[model samples]
Every structure is written in structure tokens, then in C-alpha cells.
Target: MKRHLLLTAICIITITLLNGQAQAQNLRAFMQNSGFLSLQTDTPYAETYLSVPGNSIVYKTGANGKYEGALEVTLLYLKDSNTVAAFDKYILRSPEIDDTSNITFNMLDIRRVSLPDGVYNVQMQVLDINSTDKEPLTLSQGLNMHFHRDSIDFSNIELIDSYAPTTTKNVFSKNGYDIKPYVFNYYPTSVNKISFYNEIYNLSKMVGDEDVIINYSVKHVQKDAVASNLFRFSKQKAAAVNIVFSEFDITDLPSGNYLLHIDVRNRKNVQLGEQNVFFQRSNKNSVGELSNISLLDVNHTFVTEIDPDSMVYFVKSLSPTAEMYEREYISTILQKNDPKLMQQFFYNFWQKRNPTEPEKEWAYYKRMVSYAAYNYKTAIDYGFETDRGRVYLQYGPPNHIDGSDREPGAYPYEIWQYYKLSNNQSNIHFVFCNADLVTNDYALIHSDALGELNDPRWRFKIYNTFKDGNGYRNFDIDYFRSTWGSQVDQYYGK
Candidate 1:
């Protein structure tokens, strides 16, 4: 039997996930949930590994079957909150589209950096080198590292996508280790094997002349059956410094979620240290056993006590999601007229989001929804019905908002500046102008956010108005960009 801990895949989300990342740059940063890897070899320091999301870069076709895209990644190892210690910049370009359609480049851009032992606030920026107007995508992470001089220790487990016996040396291979990193924790059906590498230091201090017992296993999530908990493999480490690099064929493991578990024990079989990372295996060859393991859905055992109509309204008030899958779900449920079932679905949705406290989560969001309704209500619509209200509810309030109502011949307009939006974009502005001119219904006319209105001529639309004996007329202007303001403070009101 293997001594192990039952890791609820749910608990892994307690800490700040990709949501804790910095705001978006030109490229929407797509990082694996656990993309950082720190490993120490032959020194008292470690090299950090991070995988930047690929495929998000705008790819264009070039002549003769080539795909053109350029990315510049800058890593700043901050000494403190405001001080920078070291930096690394990598410029990557793919001149050819080896596989254009496999756009989900899960393990696309890999970055490795060497630094001395200390905690660092890692500020990373990914920029589309092709565009001069696009903002550089930026994200920050805290990098904490410690190396003991006289104690047994292990480096973070590094996942390798594939490996082969090497006869020569290259950037991807070191000391005969020809390996490609498995950036994300996802292993599709095409990925046949899983390999990992890690370094152990000063192990002789713990075991003396005896060997260090290493247990390597992959356990199914939350399953306590004997087969799911049995031992996978165990090895003896007979050296002070060990580079444990090996691969295992996972073709037979049924398609499901698993943890590649590693445990280091002393000679007495007492667990000394352990570390593991989450991974999802998609083994299509497996029988129908894993069919039910669809997208992670909580047990549909809970129900909402709210009335059906109120529940529908609550769902409607929820932005982004309400406009997306949540809306479709409610529409389908209107046919069944089963409030209990609807409640279950609603309960499960939030439960999946904040499993520890779904009620608290709902309460907080409900408060925001109520606030939105109160502030954005108009003659024919509720607060949540307005465009500004939807954006406020969906992306939350802007960091700083500026407005101008008395500009000559200009519509009452406002610019909402968000310092950051959900690990996506930062310094983004939403320009809302009073399109109706009746009540306070300022509509979103243009924005610089990806997929949002990016009209360079927004200035003309906002200011190209003249009161010609009637209301106003659509017209033009001269050097509005220059007369408006400087580049940094681009707000219209002087």
C-alpha cells in the first residue's frame, strides 16, 4: 500500500490562480495554472521555468506556407516591491506554420531564468513585436526560493512532455536528457508518455550511508479503492546529489484527473518529504469508465430555495456569464419548470467557482448586482440593463473614471480607466457617450480592449458635432489628437 494524501482537485484553487496575474498586454497571456518551476543543480541557487501561453499571438500567413508572429518576453526579478535585481528578455518568432490549426499551443513559449537565492516579485511582459500600437501584456508573480546548506531538500518537479535517448548535446538536451517540457498539466490522447525531472541536495544528511527511498506514483482523484491507491513504483537513491529524470508510459491509465505524486522517505520508510503537481490525462483508448468524468461539475446535490422567477432574474443580472452559457442554461430550464433542478444547476455553478463558500460568493455578487441596478437605471431599463451597468457588473468598476459634459458641441461622454481587468488588460479605457441623449444612458461607443471597438477615429465621432439650428450634425474637426491633450493624459476635458 502507498502512503498518500487525497488531494481534492478543488483545493488546488484556493490560492491566487491565473486570476492573480498582471493585466493583459498586446497578447492575452495564457499561462498554465502551475506554470512556474524552480530547480537547483550543482549550486545553492535555482533556475526558474515559466510557460507563456502561445497561440494567443496574432498569426498571419506569409508567402510559401509560413506563419509570421513575433513575441518579446521580458522577465524582471524584482528585489522588493519596487526594486529590480535581475532581468531576462527573450524574443521568439515562428517563421513557419508547422501546425497552424493546432492553435491551442498549450506548452508553447518556455522561459528559463537563473537567479541567486531570494524572494522576487517577477514582473513579466509579453509583447507582440509586430505591432507598435499594442500595449505589452504584463503579469507579475512572487518567486520565493530558499536553499539549505546542511539539510536534505528537493527541487520543484519539472514535467517533460517527451524525451528520447540522446547521442549529442543541444539546447533541449543536457547530460543525455533530451526532454521537452510539458508546460500545462493537460495530457491529451496524443501524449503517450509523461516524464519528469528534479534534483535532490544534501540527502546524505538525512540517510547517512543508507539509501533514500523514493516513491513515484500517480493516484486518481478522491478514489479510495484499493486499485486506485496501490503502489506504482519505488526506488532507492544511493547518492548525495541525484537528478531523478525518468519517463513512464501512461497509455493504459484511464482518461481522468490524476496527480503525479512523489514521496521521499528515509531508510525507516518514514516519509521525509513530498511534492506533487496536478495533471489531467486524456487517454482515449480507455474504456467508457471515464465518460462520466466530464468538465468538473460539483455534486448536483444542493438546491436553491429562491423562487424560480427571482432565480431567473438573478441569473439574468449576472453579466458576461449571463450573456453566455448561463443564459442558455436558464432558457433550457424554463421548459422543465422545475425550480429544484434549476436551483441545482445554479448551485453547482457557483459551487464549482467557490466550493468553500458558494453562499458568500453569491451574496457578494448579488450586492454588486444590486449596486449596478441602483446606479445605472434609466427610463426604460433597470440599472443592470444599461451598457455601462453591464460592463460595471461584468468587469467591475473602473480604477479611475473621467467625464466631460460641457465640451463645446460634444456629447456627454465618460472614459472609464481600469488599472487591470481580470488578469487580462490594464490601462484600458471604455469610452461611453450619451448615445440616446434622453436620460443618463451612456452607451459604449468604442474601446481599446481586444475585440472591442478600436476605432482610431473615435475622437472624430465624439467631437465631430455642430449644432446647425437642430440637435447636432455628423462632421469633422482639425488636429483633435493634438488639441485634446498629451499622449499620456489623453482625456478630453482640459
Candidate 2:
């Protein structure tokens, strides 16, 4: 009797273990939660497959009368491999089942769903749970996702600039739209870039429903024709947008021109429109006026905090953006007569920021200031109070800058392009300033000689006045340009 009891216990344990192995339908759960599962499908006729939600009753026809049944399903995803190990899975909503009779296929047919543009994989399975016979069925397939293209139209469908730097309005459409502005940056002398702001309107219309795409580029005038970087986008909503492109700095570019090419497409994968903007960069440049400060001839007295040569470049860069009085200070006092003293002055300026060594954030700061001075200087101040100044002050000069400048009053503006920042981005823009003539027009034209405005705000106001004003009114180039060559030549070129 004892031997028989032990044998019965062993048989029970063996049956339980076998039942667990036969019900090992866990691959479905794995596919549902992993990155490999993708619901996106581009093909319309493609069939889908999925396992039943659980080990619930999914009966099938059998050979005997009293409704003998069995459960088994097929999954294509597992067909390639000889054995099923582990896999990710997802489930479509199962249909409510009133009866399982004659259930030839008891698995859910998997269908593809729309997903954002990216990469993914899919899988499905069928479980067997009847008649104590047959293996489970499973299927799976792989697919790639491409964004859906929807359509968007500018409310007015008119090509016009409706906004300034600080403010903009899209009045043509009462409902509103999407517009993004892209700016490109280039070297101090490159003119091949055609800088323009691209407006992407009506993006909000497709935001959640579909994807919107736009491609933008630029081409140089020469046969070598270096093109602007390609830009892509998806639109799904209505949004007003503006993108600025900067391929070169206006100040350093030669007088030749370039072309801006904009190609726009929508969610339905339709090309909405294309725009060609002709941009030219010449040599005559104007920047907002900047403040001028006089320092004692410290040329002979050296400061150790900052290097002397770097200080000179920093100061020279600022001269082009200074006001008339500031220009006079730079030309007469800073650049012309006293190189030694100027170096000491600039060296001390940075040393004040860097009282300690190796903690040199000042190197980046000074380079940005130099960049602002070089690109924003006007006839009076050079290019100083530009978007470049704000960015330079914010993040410093980017890794690269492409530049170009046009004669004042000839093309109405200049531009600077910043490309490939540490953060992986690009920008471009037209530079303008009206502050040069605001306070003391030039040192020669200063209304007050003995008591100059000591306030920084007054200096900025003078600068803004030049930046905001048109070249026909506020720009004066004679005192500074005379040092380069003939002032009359520049004046006529403008």
C-alpha cells in the first residue's frame, strides 16, 4: 500500500509539469510591451495576425459526435525560426464571442495602424487549448513606417513679408496659420549664401491627423554652386511659422549674389509650392552705433590677465559697429596712434571678468564680442547691435559663420549665417540697426562735447536709433571708411 501511494503522488506531479509546459504561450506578452512591436502598415491588402487575449476557450471541430474540440493557431512571425523562444506582441480589440463552434480560426487578425515616421517590427500568435491535442499557431511580419502627407495652404496664398524682427502678424487669414523662419550662418566673407525667412503656414490643420513635410535649400551663383542644407518638416496643425537661412556673413562677402530655393509639401505627399528668392550681398555695410569709452594710454603699462593680441582683435572688431564718436575713438585713439595702449586696455577689460586662471569662460565671451564687432559693424559702428550680438552674448560665436554684405541703400540690408552649433542647429538673417546717429552722431558730430552721456541706456538708445533707421537717413561712413580706401568710392558704390 505504501509503494502504491508513492507512485500515485509521482504521477500527479508529472502531469502538472506537463500541463505547464504545454501552456507556455508567453511570447504574446513579450511582443506587446517591447519596442519591436509596430502597428504601422503601408500595404492595404496586408493581412494581420494575433494571439487570443488569454488561455481562454477557443474551440474547434473534431472527429467525434458529442462536440469533440481542440485549439491551435498559426503565426507567420515564428515561421522563419525552427522554435519559438521569446517575442514582443500586441493585441487588437477582440470581438465578443457568442459561440466557439466550427471555429476553424480562433485568433485575432492583426491589422496595421498609422504611426509617426520611424522604424518598427510586428508579430502575432494563436494559442491551442482544446481536445488535449495540437500545437499553437503563430504569425508575424516586419514593416517600415513613413509619415502620412496632409495638405496645408496659406490663408491668403500671397507671398509677402508681414512682420519685423520684434513683431509679426498674419492678417490675410482670419483663422491663423503656421510659419517658421530659418537663419543660416557662414564665414565672415562668404557671399554665396542666399539668406531668406521661410514661412510654413497651416501646419496646425494636420497636427494630430497627418504629417506635413517641407524641403528647403540654397544654391551659390558660381558654377560650383554650393547649396544650402536641406530642411524637412511634417505639418499636422495650423501654425504661423518663419525660418531664417544664413549661408554667409554680409560684411565679408563679395558683391555677387545667390538664390534661395524653397520646396513645400504636405501630408498627402503633395508638393504644395516652390519659391525662388534672389538675394545679393555687396561690400557697403552698415551696423548700429555703439558706445565709446576713452582710456588712458596704458599701451606701455601691460596687463597680464588677457593676451595682448586677442585684445587688439576684440577692439578692432568693435570699431566697425561703433558710433561716429565711437569710430573716432577707435580710429584716432584705438587703432591709429596707439596700438600698445589699446592692447593693454582690451587685456584689462577681459581680466576684469577673469580674476583667476583656467576658468576661462571669458575666451568664449571675447570671441563672441569680436564676432559681433566684425559682423555688425556699420560705416560708423560696424555691425554691432544685430541678432548676432544678442546670440553672441547669449551663446558665443558658433563653430562656423558664413557672411555677406551689400552696399547701403542698394539691397537694403546685410546678413550673417551661423551653422552647426554644438547643439546641432543652423540660423540666418538680415542685419539692421538705427542707433548710430542717436546720441553724438560721430565724435565730430556730438552735440555735447564736455559732458557725454554716461548712461548705458542712452548708449543703447543711440544704437537702436541707428539700427532701426533706414540707411537713407541715419548711416554715415566717411570717417571710418577713409582709413580703408577712398570714401567716395564706397559712397558711390552704395
Candidate 3:
């Protein structure tokens, strides 16, 4: 199993002015971390990637009288949450800037740490060295590294931003290539291709004297089906460590959540091992595919059996799980209200999900839609239109829910935790709050899941505390402090 790790946190800091006055400001940066195993030395290691927007930090005049920004970074791996197993501390400096106001580039840094096989708690601390804030922005997550030398396994897939044949040895150099890691799994329209690197270990030991087939493909997260025009394979002689480095052109891929899968097989096509990495893509150009809907035929399809009046509702319920392009097509179909178009589009939707049994797929989804409508509907909206309803329909039921209704200084809130999402994201969380205090409708306030609303100061909105004299919520105050008689922190972390 691939142990994927993700941790994102934001902090506000106070910067000192030239005249010694202090001003509060937002310190914005993003960090992405992953772990991989080395087959050559039979060791495990962790990689940390940090990206800081140049405009978000305060640049100071250094010893050479040149403006530059710096961050103090500390990484700690703790065993059992108490004993430190590994630690790293260093200063990361940004490129020198002649004019601070025109700073538009991003500062990037990468670090690697090796460790023994065991589960550990990883803590990262980052501070703006140029700012007066004494406290650092801290975030923590769990890391598990377990690779056996006797069995075939795979390394965590590392997405690449850029790569070149290595001329010199450095932290980013691997297998004679200097790879710049793509810090985030998100790919916007600007990124046309997705490049990745992975290693298959102990293939020779597992499949002696046989050629192995390496299959890689991008698959839809919801459907678990290989995406069209995105599969590749190669045959190679068995080796102790096999490197797979490749890229896929996603310029025309639809906007949706997807997984890049790597599978190994023996000569007879028997599956050996497989791994996957989750990512999200946004491609507005892909919406042009909806124009092909007019070419679809639903005369003998399952959609034709549906009642005409329920066609729009059934199509609209798909908003929670529909891809970006599908959502647009749904809006267009609703506006046109052409029953033929709706039938064709609806049938094509399930056919794309489960080509062998499209009707069976829709049957399962119909039950879920009914469940959401019965449980989460309100006066003005159907269940699928509500935030909680949408989340349930999109991600399925959460593993755990922490609810509190009468906490002092806090509104009725529920924290939903999913042990693992369909996209391979683990330990995801969503926060919902009922501010109106009368209805069962709870609005989604925040979440730590990818592509979801992430509000570092979400507690403030739930508690309705920390407001300025202007009657507006004061967002500049401490973010993670627990208010009196509130258990939000505990609920969120749990």
C-alpha cells in the first residue's frame, strides 16, 4: 500500500516596520510532503517541498544591502509522539529582489530525510525570519514507512514540475536526473502535461528470469475506469529496482478528480503489485466534448424508461459528483429542457461510469439520491442542493462525525472525518455549522480535504467570536486558540 501524506497550514504573523512599529499581516505559503523507499540501500526517506509566494513575505535588506526574504524551517519526526527519531533545521532564502513591489515569482525549496522503517509523527515548523513574529507556523501529520526487501513493492509516485539529465549531484538528483518536484497535486489549465516518477522494487526477486509488463494509466476517481486515451505499457526484463518515469498530455482531459495508477504483471498477465496517486485536473477546453451529446442515441437505453417529469431532477442530482464539464452540460440541458437531450445525456453519463451495466450503476446512485433527499432536504432546496447532502453524495458517508450543539460561545457544529477518500486521500475532514440555530440545515464552513473550502480561521466563524468594534469578525487574531467552553479543536483533530 502506498502511504500518501498531505499537510497544509496557514499562519498570521506580525512584521516590524523600519521605525520599530509592528503590523499584523498574513504569511502565506504551501508545503507538500511525501515518503519513498530506496531499494539500493533498503532504506526509507521523506521529501518536503515548500512554495512561498514572493509577494506574501516581507523582504529585508541583508548584509549586502540587497532585499531578500528568508524562512526558518524545522522538521521533526517523532516516534510515538514523544521521542524524536529524526530532525532537520535550516534557513531557506529567496532570490534577491531589486524591487519588492514587483515581486511576482514564487520561492521554492526541497528537502529530504532518511529514516528507519516505522510509523512516526511528522511536525513541520516554518517562520518568516524577516518578520517580528516569534512563533512559527506549525503543522503535523502521520508518516508510515514500511518496505520489505523480500517482497515486491512500489515507491510513492513523485509528480515532477521539470526534469533534466543531472550534471551535478544534489538533493533533487535521482537516477541521473535532476527533478523539480511539482509541489501540489492540483493541475490547472496552464499545466498541459503530468510528469511523474516511481520505482518498482524487488521485481527480479519476485519474478525470477521473467519479463515483466509495466502498465500505467490515469483513471477516473469516481468510476474507477481507465480514462480514454491515457493508458500505456512497457515490457522490461526483471530487475531489482525498475524506474518508471513518464508524462501524460492532459490538455484535453476533462476536469475532474483522477488517479494515476501503476500496475505490475508477470508473463501470463497475472497481477503482481499496483499503486496509485491522486490528483485533480481543471481543463475548461474539455467542455467542448459536450457538443457530441447531440450525436448520442437513447432510444433503446435505460434513460428512455425514466418518467419525463423526473428527468430534470435526476440529472440535477448528479451535480454533487459530476465532472466540471458534465456540470456545464447539465446546466445547458436543464435550460433547454429537451427530454430527448436529457435522456441521451443521462444514459451516456452512467454508460461512461459502468459500460457493462450502466443501468445497475444508476440504480445504486438513485438509492443514494433518495437517501439524501429524505434526510437533508429543506424548505427551499432538495437534499442534493445542500452542502452536507452534496458532500454525502459525492464522497459517500463519512467514517466518523463529531457533533456539538450546546457548546458555549459556539454554534451547532459537526465535524465529519473520512478515514480514506475515493481519491486515496486519508484522514480528511469537513466542518459544518448551523448558525441559524433553528433549521437542520448545516452549512459547510471548512474542510481539510483537497479541492474543498479550507479556512484556517474556521473556528471563528463557528463560534462567532473575536469581532472588532466595527462589528465585523476580526480575522487578524490568533487562529487556533480554543475559545472558552468550546471543544472544536478536539473535535476537529479527532
Candidate 4:
């Protein structure tokens, strides 16, 4: 069975403004939760983190005559039969502001809940208390927490924004440190380092006071291999509870999806236990060193065997899996129109992924590209250039697809569900729609996957519900509530 450890949930909220009429306003917020085990107490607990931008909410005069925004946050953990296992409901208030227009800070909240070892469905709801909207934003996902008492296990990795020696015992304090949770798994250009906290339990039972090696590294999601420069290891004595509070300098890390792995190895160099968390980096300045490509020897290599024209097409097909910097480099190589340069770059790309089997890697990817092209080609674009094709090439095939072409009051839409993504994400979904209807090409409008398009007003586009004067799509809550013959919500939720 797979474990559901770190989960990042995104919710879209509809706030109703009251001025004798209800106006729909949209707000987006992020929520993340992780489960951990307390060996000392023999208990399991969960930590929930929420981040809501202050400017996205409405502020009203408070009891102290100051403008403030408040959100009523609720969390519910349900069992297999839909029975509530644990729940929490509370009001999270933002800092008092002198002017609502200047509200630019994010309101962060943390909650800790104790739960036993079991699988659960977690539901979260958030509502702006100041808004007249009666309905709140809600989202649900799965959660699992299981740690055997006699076997070595790792707690879910918690990404940290900042940490210092604990001055007071608070909800954020853990293992003598006051750790601020980095709610999002996304790290933009401004974030230069990645810090995390994790715990290993029952090590003493397995190793019996023997010294073990703790190795942690950042691995590229596509290559499934550790980055050469980002690996580290340390020696420690096995104990009942071992803690790892460390960080890696990601200043030079390129923009791509990656996994941070924590592994425990026994004294005899045997594997014991491992845990990994997914994250995305966006460092636009750290482009691939294209100048180094000239130094690579492509003579007699696999790329030399391909015709010049075919090599260009093959290089273009790499867009789905190429990093931001690599894509930029590929464009340069294509513009240069140098066969040797393109072959060198192409061979190097596959070589990085599979040092000993670059040809095998390219052969397999060539097959996938051909398949995607054959199935998803559009009128003017190749299958790889289309949205659905791009997604298929990038993430492989979906586990299930719910496609509807004749739904009432809605465009042809399809919801593709992936039971699990290669990056360790579970139950991910992608929403695609064909508005023109004539073309079979389905454009991706929304997705719950990290680093993909996430449009809160996706339903509006699919249903053709409402648009403002400027022809911009706007979500109409009233229409959604009264509309008939639309099962998109049901299909998407499933």
C-alpha cells in the first residue's frame, strides 16, 4: 500500500460583496497538511498549514474600530464510511490594517490535530466572515498515517520557511526549534534555499544502538537520479527517535520539478527506510550552461546516426520534458541550425538522464512522441504542440478519462485522472475543454498538479456561463447554483 504523506490543496473561494446586490469576487488560497508520529507519546498527529493573501479578502471595521479580515476555517477528517474521525473549526483573523488598499501581506495559520493510524478523507473549508457569501470554499483529498512500532519508519517531510532555537513552547515548536512551515511546495526565484524537518522512528529497535548513515539529496523528477552537486550524508547512532533538521542551498538549482529524498542505511550499507517530498523550483536566472554543449563529443554517438532534418524534429519533441533553461537552449540550437550543435545538445540531454543508455532513453521517448502525435494531432499543430498531447507526453497516459461531448449547457470537456504522478503526487486531475467543438483538440484549462495551469474560473469557461464586457470570463455563483443539466462538478470531484 502507498502512503499519503504530504498533501498540498488549493481552494477557490467566492466572496459576495453586499451593496444592495451580491457581486461575486474570487479568492485563491493554499492549504497543506502532513502527518507525523511521536515515538515518546506513542501517538500520531497531523499539522495543517494555511496561507491566504490579505488583499484577496474583504476587510471590515472590527470591534476596536480597525479594519480587519477574518476567515472561518474548518477541517474534517472522515473515515471510509464517511463518518467524521476528527474535526476542527476556528476563526483565523488577519492583522489589523489602517487601509484595506494597502493590504499586501499573507495571513498564515497552523493547526495540529491528533489522529490514530488509519486512512482518511480530509475536507477543508474556508469562508470570508466579512463577506455576505453564504457558501464557503471547500476541497477534499485523501490522507494516510501508518507507522509500525517494531519497524523503522519516517515521518512526512515538512518544508520549513525559517527556524530558530525555540524560545517558547508553541504549536510551531518542535525538537527545540521554532519552525515556520513553508506552506507551498513551490519555490520561486526569490527563494534561494530549501529547509526541511523530518523524523525517523523505531531505529533503535532495528539497529540496536549501531551507527547508521543518513543520506539526503535532491533528485530530478524525470531522471529519477540524485543531483551530482546536491548530495550529503552524515553518521549518527540509531535511537528510538532520530531527527533531521537541515537545508540545501538551491541558489543554482534550475527551474524544474524535483524530489528531496531522506534515506537511512544500516552499518553494513544495507537500505533501511526512505522518504521523499516533491517540490518545484523556478529560478529563471539559472539557465543551463549552453556553452558547455560545444565541448561534448557527439562523433560516432547516437545523434550522429540520425539525419539532420529528423534530429531537429526530435529536439523539438523534447519540449514536454525539458526544463525552462533547457527549452531556451533548444530554441537557440534550432535557430542556429547547426547539425553538430543540435546533435551534441540532443545526445547530452538523454545522456544526463541515462548515462549508459542514452540511445535506449531516446528510443523509448521517440515511441511516446509518435503515439502522442498520432492520437492528439490538431488541424494546424502536431499532437505534441497541442495541450492534451503535451500533457500526455509530459505525464504519460491518464489512469481514467471522463469525456463528454454532448453535455447540456457545456462545451466538450474531459477530466483526466492520474492515480499517482511520477513526482509522488496522488489522485491528480487535469481538466480539458474543446470550446470550438469543431476541432478535437482539447485545451487544458485546469489541473491540481504542481506547476500546471490552475484556473479557478475553469468551470465558467467550460459551461459558457458568463463573461464580462471586456470578454473576460467571470464566475457566476448564482448561475452555477440554478443551472441545470451540468454534471461537471460531479465528474471533476470523482
Highest lDDT model number: 3
Global lDDT of model 4: 0.78
Model 4, 364-423: lDDT tens digits are: 989999998898898898888899889898898899889689886778999999998776
Pairs of colliding residues, candidate 1: 24-424, 24-425, 25-136, 25-137
lDDT of each: 0.57, 0.33, 0.79, 0.78
What ranking of all candidate models by lDDT puts the best one first? 3, 4, 1, 2
Better of 1 and 3 by lDDT: 3
Candidate 4 residues lying further than 4 Å off, grouped into runs, are 5-25, 63-65, 132-134, 291-312, 328-344, 351-364, 376-381, 385-494
Ten contiguous residues minimizing lDDT sum, candidate 1: 4-13
For 236-324, candidate 3 gives per-residue lDDT tens digits of: 99998888999999998888878899999999999998887778888867765576888987788778888988998999999998986
Task: Give model 3's TM-score versus the native structure.
Answer: 0.75
Instruction: Compare candidates 1 and 3 on TM-score and give the better one.
Output: 3
Off by over 4 Å in 1: 1-55, 58-67, 79-82, 96-112, 189-192, 220-231, 248-257, 281-494
RMSD vs true structure, all candidates: 14.8, 30.0, 6.8, 7.4
**Model 4 reaches what TM-score against the true structure?**
0.74
lDDT of 2 by residue, 1-494 (tens): 00000000000101111321322223231112111112133221212323233333333333332222233333222211222322334333333333332233323332333333332223344444442534333332232222223433221111221224323453222114322221111212323233333334435544543445655554443222433233334333334332323333345333333444455666666775554433344433322111222343344433344465655555655432222333344555454545555654455444444546422645565566766666554454433444445445433454433222222322122222344322222242212223333421122111110111111112222233233342312212111212222222232222
Candidate 1 achieves a global lDDT of 0.57
Which of candidates 2 and 4 reaches a greater lDDT?
4
lDDT of 1 by residue, 44-131 (tens): 3333344544455555455565556677877666653345666778887754554444554532554455555555555566677654
